[model samples]
Target chain A: MAIEVRIPTILRTYTDGAKAVEGNGATLDALFADLDARHPGIRARLVDAGELRRFVNVYLNDEDVRFLDGINTALGDNDNVTILPAVAGGSV
Target chain B: MKYDTPLEAVGNTPLVGLPRLSAAIPGNLGSDGHGAGAVRLWAKLEDRNPTGSIKDRPALHMIERAEADGRLTPGCTILEPTSGNTGISLAMAAKLKGYRMVCVMPENTSEERRELLRMWGAEVIPSPAAGGSNTAVRVAKELAAEHPDWVMLYQYGNPDNAGAHYATTGPEILADLPTVTHFVAGLGTTGTLMGVGRYLREKVPGVTIVAAEPRYDDLVYGLRNLDEGFVPELYDASVLSTRFSVGSADAVRGTRDLLQQEGIFAGVSTGAILHAALGVGRKAAKAGERADIVFVVADGGWKYLSTGIYTAATTEDAVEALQGQLWA
Candidate 1:
């Protein structure tokens, strides 16, 4: 079984327009490595210096990975990972 | 219960318990499986405010702070980017205090919000709906530059916005439910979370501050995903213990459940907040720990009635009906 990763509109270019791609790893770090193997250069946009990029947000099963273990957050077989650029949020 | 004016009656909303819904959660029963009141849910009914949403707290506070700081004065124009509630609250306050109100709102927000803003004597400028409130904020910023005299009490970054909750909402909650173990609220400008989170953290030991963020691309009105490129300046991630991305489907289900089971009619964002509240409650129940989780009922269902969420035959249908329109 593999983890499902949903890509955002801006990052879809890295996935060749594929909205979602599957990767296998026990932890998010390994999952990005697995994904980078198939989709080269995609990991750079999401991570820098072994940390999640400033504007990029990755969620595992709808929970923010930042509050988890960051890039080291564990991944389950059926986990859903979503990657999106940080945008201004809220009704300010 | 008595106030000098409607503007004076903004805060001190009721914090009511959700007994029926709390008991309905399966694992809420005690270890011996008899008592079902260990895990409880409470709603901070911010809908009871003057403008019918929690925004009233921040809107009034921001404006008042600006006034006290000499940024806002008599006959000054107040500019803000709002999905709805903040504009309405600001407009009402401005009208009463003799200030002009201009709101830059998303074009896709419900018509009810537009009419309400107009009724409150505020001019509305429509921002693009593609990027949601992000676009609105950008437009407001551009307009603020052009109108130098226009005081933009930017709620997203304003300290007083969060300060409102810290000074009032937090104290009221602690006073009403001193045992509150967790505080959950919809993640909008992050004012509610940051302010109340800080206040609760200072008093309540190990209080879990949970943010019920709308899932990216879910289009729940008045809520934004932090990853969407615009984290409100007021949003301090450290203040939040954890964040839950609630989708339209779950938000719809939560709204319907609150209405059906608890008879609490609230907007879609409240549904998302309640969903997170229940999530943490379930965790506490499973661990057999007593918890008092309080979530914000941001607003009433009156403005959202036109969206058909409350009357839809099923939650799926309600979610489907909410597409393309901002339901929160």
Candidate 2:
């Protein structure tokens, strides 16, 4: 299954500055492993200690993955994954 | 409708049904042929508040709580970090309460927002656009440290912020629509989501709380390493069932859809909430489940009038015109 993952600007150095990249995995943990296989050391930035980094947010089709099973969230073909840094919100 | 003070009228906004928009969503044909128990959309018209925004509830509640506890006294200066609405609400309340108000806002916010703050006699300090509200919060904290006399009502961490929503907004929605299955709102300081989400979760069985977070351009995260992004202290992920990051273009499109389809003119952040609400509505419809989705219209679009998003001929042109600027 192919899933397109959107990369944040800070992590672009791993994807050669590509805004998005395609990888295959049934779950987020496996997807990151797949991404690291091709991108080299990118998984370490997103995951550590067998969990997602505190500052790194991974969303599957815009819905936060943390609520949906975290790294174990299921993935499917044509799923759009987005990675972003944790930022404070104040749209009041 | 009679109140001794404007602050007394901070909440109790009307909840109106969006029959047209709800009927527009595609659902299973087999569900109650008349569309009964299918799906419905309800909008909490928070723009009708005294300050024309939902933030008035928290701003007033926070200030009053402080005043009642003696943390805020006569001749005290109030401080906060806001995008616009909260500052404007606080400024108005402070002016009426005889307290000086100062706001640290992002430089990227609209000019109209600045004018509104100034109109209410609030001093505006513009933080760098690099990190948006994150920068504003940092700057506000620094300023508060320099002047120990200034009372920063720090919305992000203050429990009173969420308390306002829990005490008023949540009860109002439950009273107005007992059948509400989902609650959606913009995720900012996470006050609204936290307070209302907690209240509804306790009162309603199997209620879903959804968050629509604004996804800004890279400039909002400018030069910050991956570890630098900040999360609100009040944010409890357990309070939210799911969260969707809505980009500016989608936000604008959602705003236009509300205006065109439902005739509700709301701020860009509210647009993000509506977009997420509709997304959930679509999924529920596909599942042939009954749903009453209520989303907050945080404020009117007047503050963002200069953005030309509402009058633009097309959503693409509107979004293109919105580029490089923070809409939410």
Candidate 3:
């Protein structure tokens, strides 16, 4: 199964400047491992000690993976993964 | 409802029903095709506030709370980091109370917001747009330090921001819809959800408080993602049942749906909130449970008209038109 992972601007360098890359894994952890195989050191930026980095937010199909199963969240075919750096949101 | 002054006319907005939109959802329709047991949607029309947005509730309350405690005295300058509504609300209050108002806002915010702030006699300071509101908040904090005399209400971390909703918005919703099963609002400073969520949780046996957060990098005007560096001090995860991340396209679609189906022309963030409300409503309907979902209409669309959202040819066009601009 092919899952599309969208990379943030800050981490575009690791993806060879590609905005999105394709990977396959049953779970997000395995997905990251697949991505790391293709893009070395990319996994390190997103994960630290098997936990998602504090400044990184990963969403699977617009749902926060943190609220789901975090890195262990199961991935399905046709799922879209988005990774973004934590920035201060809009001021209300 | 007649009030002594405009400031006194902050809350008590209309709670209108969205029968058409609610019935359009397949899940909301009963098995027998009747209205009973159908998931329903109610809008708390916060755009009806004096300053034309829900921020009036917190802005007025924060200033009043500060005044009551002697922190904000006459002639003091009130500083804040705002993309639009809060600054305009504060400026209106400051003008009436004989205090100077200053707002640190992102440069990418709609021109209407800048003009509104200036019209209300607030001094506007523009921050960089790279990191969005995060940059604005940092700049405001720096400015506050440089000008210690200026009292920054600091809505992101201020208790009064949420306290304002707890005291007024929360009670108003319950009084209007006692059977409200779900409460949804945009996630910004987290004041609305925390305040209203806590209030409903105490009174209602089982109430679901859902937060509608902007999708990361989607940039819906006034909403925020908690995972983002700055979690509003008022935010408590325990208070929320679940959070939905909405993208700009979905937000635009929801906004158009509200205007087209229900005639509620609200800000972009409200559209995101409605999307989340509908999501939860669908879940409850799928479970064959009755639900009374109430969502917030954060602000009016007047300020966002220049962004071409309401008049765009299509939802995609609307989303494109809103690029790099804070439509909420």
Candidate 4:
């Protein structure tokens, strides 16, 4: 099984316009590293100095990684990862 | 149940149990497992407030605080950026206070919201729909800068926004349900989460505060660089135990479920909050731990009725109707 990472529209340039890409790793950091090997410079936009950027939100399944273990959060091959830009919430 | 004025009834909303929902979800045995105590889901019906939304609390509080501090005086012009509820709330309060109200809102919001604001005597300025409320906030800021006389009670940065919940919402929830184990609410201005989260932390030990945020579709983020993403200044990560982002489809499903199962008709954002509450409750139940979870219903379903979310044949059909609109 491979871990699927869904890319946001703004970050699709790293994946050659593909909406999602598959990679494998035991943890998110390793997964990002593995993804970077194929999709270069994608990790820098998501992470800043070993931490997630303030405006970037990453979710595994439906849960936020920051609440689990940040970059060290464990990843399973079947787990789906979603990356999104944090914008002003539309709860009107 | 009596108030001298409509504004005086902004809070003290009911905290009712969601028994049917709780029983349907498996593994909801409370810690002690005593007659519905095993698992409980409480709804804080902020929809019962004066302006038919929770924003009434913060809007009234911010305006009153400003009036006290000399920032807002009689007949002053008020400016704000809102997706819907906040503008309606401010417009209601502004009209009563003899103040002129102007709101910067995204062009994609519901028609009922615009009518509601106008009905309350507020002027509406439409911001581009690409960035959603973030664009509205930016436009409102520019307008404020141009007109120094206008009092922009910026909800995103205003302390009173959260303070209102701290003083009223938090205490009301605690008083109503002292055993509340989890508090869940939609993440908008972040005022509700920060204010109530802080107060709950101080009063209840080991209480969990969760924020359920909307996952805007690509159209909402259209052509915008990552640098342009907006996070409210009122947001402080430490106040929340965790956050979840719900997509539009799930929000619609949850909204329908709430009305169908519990007969509680609430907005789409309330569904997102309910989704998070149900998730945590399910987790606790699976672990054989008892919990009392409370979620906020930000507003009634009236404003969104025009979106066909209530009468659509399928969730997908309902979702399609709200596509690119600020239904979240």
Docking outcome class, model 2: medium
CAPRI grade, predicted model 4: medium
Let me know the TM-score candidate 3 reaches against the reference structure: 0.94
* Model 1 per-residue lDDT tens digits across residues A1-92: 68999887676677898879999998999999999998899888788999998877888988899999999998888899987666555434
| Candidate achieving higher lDDT, 1 or 2 | 2
lDDT of 2: 0.90
TM-scores for every predicted model: 0.95, 0.97, 0.94, 0.97
Number of clashes recorded per candidate: 11, 0, 0, 3
Better lDDT candidate (2, 3): 2
DockQ, structure candidate 1: 0.49
Model 2 lDDT per residue over B262-291, tens place? 899988888888899999999999887888
Query: Could you give the interface RMSD of candidate 1 in angstroms?
Result: 5.1
lDDT of 4 at B162: 97
Q: Best by lDDT, which number?
A: 4
lDDT of each: 0.87, 0.90, 0.86, 0.90
Candidate 3's C-alpha runs over 4 A off are B31-37, B216-228
DockQ each: 0.49, 0.72, 0.43, 0.73
Instruction: Name the 10 consecutive residues with the lowest summed lDDT in model 3 chain A.
Output: A82-91
Cα shift from native, residue B67, model 3 (Å): 1.0
Native contacts recovered, each model: 0.48, 0.70, 0.39, 0.69
- Clashing pairs for predicted structure model 4, backbone only: B29-B38, B30-B38, B31-B290
Q: Model 4 over residues B155-267: C-alpha lDDT tens digits?
A: 99999999999999999999988988999999989999999999999999999999998986789877667766888889899999999989898899889999999999999
Chain B: TM-scores of all predictions: 0.95, 0.97, 0.95, 0.97
